[model samples]
Target: MQIKSVFIVEDDPSLQSLYEKILSYYGYTILGVARNGEEAVKMFVDFQLKPDIIIMDHRLPVKDGIEASKEILIYEKKAKILFASADKTIKDAALSIGITRFIEKPFDISVLIENIKELIDVKI
Candidate 1:
């Protein structure tokens, strides 16, 4: 199987590290990490080779995931982003903006891995 690449956008350092280690262990190439939504958008736009998936958090400094996702999607309509957030209220807003995957926070790592796999397997 071809190794899928992932981009992580999270503010918490511990979660970021954990995601990097866990996803890497699962054979997904962690392309890079962004600590804020603004940084995430900029990095995604400038990526020489865009990641196959993006794990995004809603609450962030500088900008929130929703706005950043809107910007990124405008640039790349098919960008696959997985909304990984604790804020349950924003699910509908996220989905409205074309983010098809939503994984609530405090989720099992295995679930996250499975979701990533499913998103990567999708032919969109």
Candidate 2:
């Protein structure tokens, strides 16, 4: 299925805004914004908002993305999660939890967009 909507779990405001702008430009709907994993879970549950894809940060307050993703995936097994982090340890942790895509922080916007497009195309 084509990824039309995306949920972003990012703690950094600047990066969050940049991602929102870039993804919106690509015609992907921004379902909601959460500053941390706790908020993300709350938003997902309260709104029952299901996005086609999820762009998550590895390090987050309250719960962290890996735990949140695990919980979210329990509800939606087909959930596609792309994790981003500056720390290799965090990325490794995410991967160990079965997260397939890992994007390094301070990434080029163009590269990020292309990766997102590719993930959406693959539908995994």
Candidate 3:
């Protein structure tokens, strides 16, 4: 299945814009961008057009990434959540909740793009 839609959950405004722009440049339709985990979940649930991919950040206001992912997963088990974080401590926590894909901080944009593309191409 080709991934066409994407949502970004990040606290930083710059990062949010960057992701939106870069992903759009790659031809992915941007569903929306959320600043916090709470907002992310709300957007997911409320929006009629469900996203094909969600780029989630670890640390967030109101709710952390793991908590938000759990909530969303409950609603959409097959949701492909791409966890992004600088903190190494979150790997286990993220994986425990079935979020297997991760992009480390300070990563190259090319690497991030490659990972997202790979995810969209995967059948599972």
Candidate 4:
């Protein structure tokens, strides 16, 4: 149950690119990167690419991460989402939706890697 495919929903271009490159280095195949929830949903549908895990930003345009995650989960119940955000309010919202793992902004990359590894392990 290796986590090979991943989808990242983030608005910041630099962060998005950094995530992509870092994850790729760790041997995870990137399914796609979406700047907003709407684009995320559309890309998920259009590609029919079901990623093993999703790393999502809580604050997004068109739709927030919580809303997008719920919508995505409606179709893919086993979807594992990791919420990454700077806002405490967003963390609360994510927790309300039963999201267990969250990474605060300005996080250490090593810490993120460990967290991501643990998340994938739990899902498997």
Top of the candidates by TM-score: 1
Candidate 1 overall lDDT versus native: 0.93
lDDT of 1 by residue, 2-117 (tens): 88899999999999999999998999999989999999999998999989999999999999999999999999899999998888888999999999699899899889999999
- Compare the candidates by lDDT and give the number of the best one: 1
Pairs in steric clash, model 4: none
Candidates in order have lDDT scores of 0.93, 0.82, 0.89, 0.83
Candidate 4 lDDT tens digits, 4-44? 78889999999999999999999889999999998887777
> After superposition, which runs of candidate 4 have C-alpha atoms over 4 Å from their true positions?
1-3
Please give, for residues 82-113, the per-residue lDDT of candidate 2 as tens digits. Answer: 88888876777787776768988878988788
Ranking by TM-score: 1, 3, 4, 2
Candidate 4 achieves a global lDDT of 0.83
Name the weakest run of 10 consecutive residues (lDDT summed) in model 2.
44-53
**Cα displacement (Å) at residue 40, model 1:** 0.5
Q: lDDT of candidate 2 vs native?
A: 0.82
lDDT of 3 by residue, 40-93 (tens): 999999989788789999999999999999999988888889999999788888
TM, every model: 0.97, 0.88, 0.94, 0.89
Q: How many clashing pairs per prediction, in order?
A: 0, 0, 0, 0
- After TM-score superposition, the amount by which residue 40's alpha carbon in candidate 3 deviates from its true location, in angstroms, is 0.6
Candidate 3: worst-modelled 10 consecutive residues by lDDT: 115-124
Which candidate, 2 or 3, has the higher TM-score? 3
